[model samples]
Target chain A: MKKFTCIVCPISCSLAVQAEGGGDITVTGSKCDRGKAYAKDEYLAPKRVITTTVKIDGADIALLPVIGTAPVPKELLRTCLRHLYGIKVTAPVRMGDVIERDILGSGVDIVAARSAVIKKG
Target chain B: MREITADIAVVGGGPAGMSAALRACGLGAKTVLIERDAALGGILNQCVHDGFGLLRFKKQMSGSQYAQQFADAVYESSASVMTETTVLKLIPGECGSKAQSRQGLYTTGEKTGGALIRAGAVILAMGCRERPRQQAGIVGSRPAGVLTAGAVQKYINVEGYLPGRKAVILGSGDIGLIMARRMTLEGIDVAGVYEIMPSPGGLRRNVAQCLDDYDIPLRLSSTVTEVHGKKRVEGVTVADVDAARHPIPGTEVFVPCDLLVLSVGLIPENELSRDAGIEMDPVTGGPVLDNFMMASVPGFFAAGNVSAVFDLVDYVSDTGEAAAEGACRFLGGEALPEYVTVRAGDDVSFVLPGKIRRDLPSSALYMRVKRTIENAVLEILADGKPVYEKKHPIVTPPEMVTARFHESAGSGVPDAGGLTVRILGD
Candidate 1:
């Protein structure tokens, strides 16, 4: 049995999950179906969207904000961010432009959150 | 001085101000919104993190994305917007007079010293500001690297500069917790988060996602006693505090760090409210409001953080709409009925709309608890009789609670002496 708070909503419902050896799991204390689904996935394989900034060269701004196009495995967030920190892209980047595809082989693309235009020298 | 006239003037172009301006214009009022910044989103532009607009939009979105939704609406509406404009002063009209006589002193470019804006009504939504290090009373010399959490956030998210390589956060507020995760993602070392309260000041989800997920240590009942540095922040002294929040002697431990980020708290920005001669609530640190969101002066109204700090932006928008409706009613020349005082009882901190107009169709009392409690029952009493009650699994100070009352509920009592809200442990 494991206990945790469901982050699916602001209610923060307290959840308790009990799993049998045969992969059977029962989640209790969830207020909504979303919480139940979140708890089940959290017990099985947790995933989260990682948002951060990446360096951009020859742009009006020094950095561009980016986010994972899809939720990646929870444990791989740090590795993904480390890879992103070391990389830099030059502008004419648009929102949703993929800076890195299949980041860390997690099958998630890191995309720009906003457009950054090249600065005229 | 140049003179401009409008039916409604909204100060501050943040989410609250934009929503209020839109609502007023939708009600057929000639509205103008003044924003001090070049853009309209205000602080939301710098807040790029996700988890906003869940309540209003029913979908999770980033702060800037949520703000853009409102900003787009404001742009499409009939309301006129003045960017890069500052309101120097608010001059109230005759006390208890109608809504059309008030005037605001404003300035646009540097060359234009000042201009006068005469409006039927004014809605103040300037929002709150971060409590700086000096207000926290930490014994230390002034240093460069010492900055507030909001400043660090703006620098990293907007300016795109890493403020420091290593940092120690002084308070465990939501901003500090979020910054802990942000700095960690940027490969900055977070020494630890020291909070003076027994429990975390931020939301539970923030504690879990921002601090616990990143392996950042959260030390409750602890605080930074002193700062150590001559030029830049070299370190900070952490110590545990006693029940009275005084630092216990001989428990100081020095931790080395390059930056000291203060997330102490927020104070409602109410300079215009004060200058307008509106009555203030000392406990909430904002103007005293009525059920219609009107200040003591009839034509002046306030909402959002300019009235009081709110936990969620959804509530801020709600208040904005309410203030707009109130302004419309005042402009329509509707007579106000008798007002009943709303008081805070045991275990409750304070309540917004200190008074309620008996003629209102319905009124909602927003309040916070003094402390965390479990298995509690919240009750609203009128003339020592319970008028409303609701059971809660748990309640915390960080989360605001709202209770609604209709005029029909008080039909029997001709003149309810007072209404009080209390939280009782089960």
Candidate 2:
């Protein structure tokens, strides 16, 4: 049995999961249904949303913040960030503008968090 | 001199100030918000992290996205905002005098020649500042590479500059934990995060997501004893501390790093409040306020980090609304009743709103613990008589707890000597 803290809410329920080799698991100490689902997903396939900044050209600010539209595999987070660091976008981009699609074959698009306008000289 | 008059004046344009201004305008009071920065978002602009607005918005959002929601509301409201304008001085208003009505003076903009604002009420929402290396008592040669966690956030997230290839962070607070993850993402190697206390200072979720997820080690009962760089930070010396937090000799270990980030703590910005003759709570390091959020000065109010360091932005916004309502009531000539002093007792670090009104409706008392405890019961006593008690599985100093009390819960007990909140082991 492995112990984990459910991050679905501020309650932070401590869950104990016992997993068998044949794709079966038992969860204990969850106060709600969300905690159970969180434990199952965490044990089977953990995922997390990646938020980071990317360099921008021709903008008032030097970097623009971006985030993956969907949760990506936890193991591929570093790969996704490395790919993001290599790419640079231009200004006049909208908040939801897509910077990259299907990042690292994770089927998630990285989108801008805020609009950046070109600085007038 | 140019004079701008409004019913209510809000200082600072961060989450607290924006919410206060919006709530004041919603209460039908002409409100004016003054911001020193060029924009209204304040520090939220560079906070590009997620997990904000979880409680209030019911969904996780980025700091800028959460701030933009409030900023857009303020722009659509009737409140007038003055950006790039700094409030230089706050002159107390006349109170209980027949000659002139109560109106406070707000001097803004230029130092010598600036606009004067007279309002019926003033709300101090000026946020807190991070404790730097000097404040943390880290003896070292002054260098260019020493930076606060907030500064590094701005440099990387806003300016797109890699401060250094290797970094050593002192203090395991939220900012330090988040920055460790951020630096790791940018290809910077974080040596470790050292905390003097046995327990981490940041939230458990942050420890899990930011540190544990990134395979970063958290060194507890340890601290940075010295910085080892002259021109720029070349390294830092880490040492273990005894129970008394005294440095344990001969245990010093030196690690090489170019950047040293400090996330020690935050001090509430209360210079204006102190200058305005408001009584302050030594424990909170903020103004002593009553249940209505009114300071000792009759027409002056305070909220947000200016009132006390808060862990959550949602609570800051809540205080803003509460202070706004208090200001509205003051403007409507509703006199507050006598107050009952509230004190912190055993295992309790401090409590916000040092006093409570006799006729208050329902109020929440926010407090922190001095140390971590398990299976504890938090009790609220009135004159040594228990009025409220609640059980908790675990309590830590990093997270602030709130205890609610109704009007009939003896919070307004007449002739009550005092009210105290304490934590007792179960």
Candidate 3:
């Protein structure tokens, strides 16, 4: 048996999960369908979106914030952030511009979360 | 000093200010937005983490993304934006001298010198600031690495630098929890998070996702008592706190860390509002507002953190839109009606829009619970008679709950001299 808190909404339902072997699983204490689905996914293959900053050159700011286009495997978050930190981009980056495609083969693209304009001379 | 005139002048350029400016401008009012920062996004530029805009935009995104959406819209709109400008004073215009009681907004630009913006109405949207070390009651040495969670966020996300390799977070607020994950992801070693209260101060989702996911220990009823080392933070003394939140003398343990991040609490930035003589709510630490977000003074409106410290930015933007509408109406020569007082009853901390007028078809009231309640029923009574009620699975102090009183619910609420918002738990 495992316990989890549903993070899908503000309700924050506490879900109790019972699993038999690796096949049968039962989830209880969810008040809504979304919470139930979240519990199932959380118990199975947990995924999370990554939001981090990467180095940027010739921009007004030293760093540009980025977000993963899709939720990747939870364990791959560090690897994705490390890869993003190692890479640098020039100024004039627009929001939603892809910075890295298929990051760590997680099928998640790292896109610029905010625009970085060129520094004024 | 240079002089500029507009129909409405909005203070602050964060989510609330931007939304208010956009709404006021969209309604064909000449609006001027004044921001203190070089950019219009304000603190959201440092808040790179996701989980924002779920209610406003209907899409969960990063704070920067949420802010940029409004920034882009403001830029595209006809509203005039003045960045890197500081508001010196808010001078109320003489009554009957100008239509709708105009105001003089004295401001100083970064490079363009001083200016006085004369507008018919003003919107106060300056956001809140995090409480610092002194306010948190920690007896510590002055150390270099001691910084607020927001400062650390700025250092890592905006400046691209880590504050320290090992860190100890003092509060379990949402920012502290998020920073624990953020610092850990940035290769910093988070020793643990020590919270003074038995329960966490932030939302449950943050405790699960930020602390639990990272294997970070959250020690409840524990606090950082003292700081050690000089120049930089070398360690901190963690102590077990009693029910009264006093440090137990014999239970002190020293935790070695180079960084101490403080996420104690947030107080609404209301210096301008306070100095302008607007009545404030002692509980909320913001201005006392009517249903339309109007403060005590005529033609002066308050919204966002300046009105109250909202749990979500969506509510902040919501109040911004409402305040803008009120300002527009004031400019259109509409008089404010009499407002009935709304009191916070049993198990309730505080309620916003402390008063409401009878004429509005609907009004939204935001409040927080004094403590945790299971199977909670929120009841709104009009002069001791129940008029509106809502049921919630659970209610906690960390999360703000909202209830709306619509005309469809009942009609006697508007005329009631007093209303009480309370939580009934079974």
In candidate 3, which residue ranges exceed 4 Å CA deviation? B94-96, B411-413
Kindly list the per-residue Cα lDDT of model 3 for residues B1-426, writing each as its tens digit: 688889999999998999999999989999999999988887888889999988877888999998888999999999999998999999887423776437888899767579988899999999999999999886656978889999999889887788999999999998999999999888899999999999999999999999988899999999999999888889999999999999999999999999999989889999998888889899999989888888988889988887777879889999999999989988999777778999999999899999888778888899989999999999998878888889998899999999988746864654555888999999
Query: What is the two-chain DockQ of model 3?
Result: 0.84
lDDT of 1 by residue, B343-367 (tens): 8999999999889887787887899
lDDT of 3 by residue, A1-121 (tens): 8899889887888898888786978899999988888888889888989898888999988888899888998878777777787999999999999999999888889999988799999
Binned by DockQ into CAPRI classes (incorrect, acceptable, medium, high), candidate 3 is: high
Choose 1 or 3, whichever is better by lDDT: 3
Superposed by TM-score, candidate 1 places the C-alpha of residue B405 at a distance from the truth, in angstroms, of: 2.3
Ranking by lDDT: 3, 2, 1
**Candidate topping DockQ:** 3
Q: List chain B TM-scores, each candidate.
A: 0.96, 0.95, 0.98
**Interface CA RMSD of each prediction in angstroms:** 2.2, 1.8, 0.8
Better of 2 and 3 by TM-score: 3
Tell me which of candidates 1 and 3 scores higher on TM-score. Answer: 3
In angstroms, give how far residue B417 of model 1 lies from its true place.
Answer: 1.0
Clashing residue pairs in candidate 1, if any? none
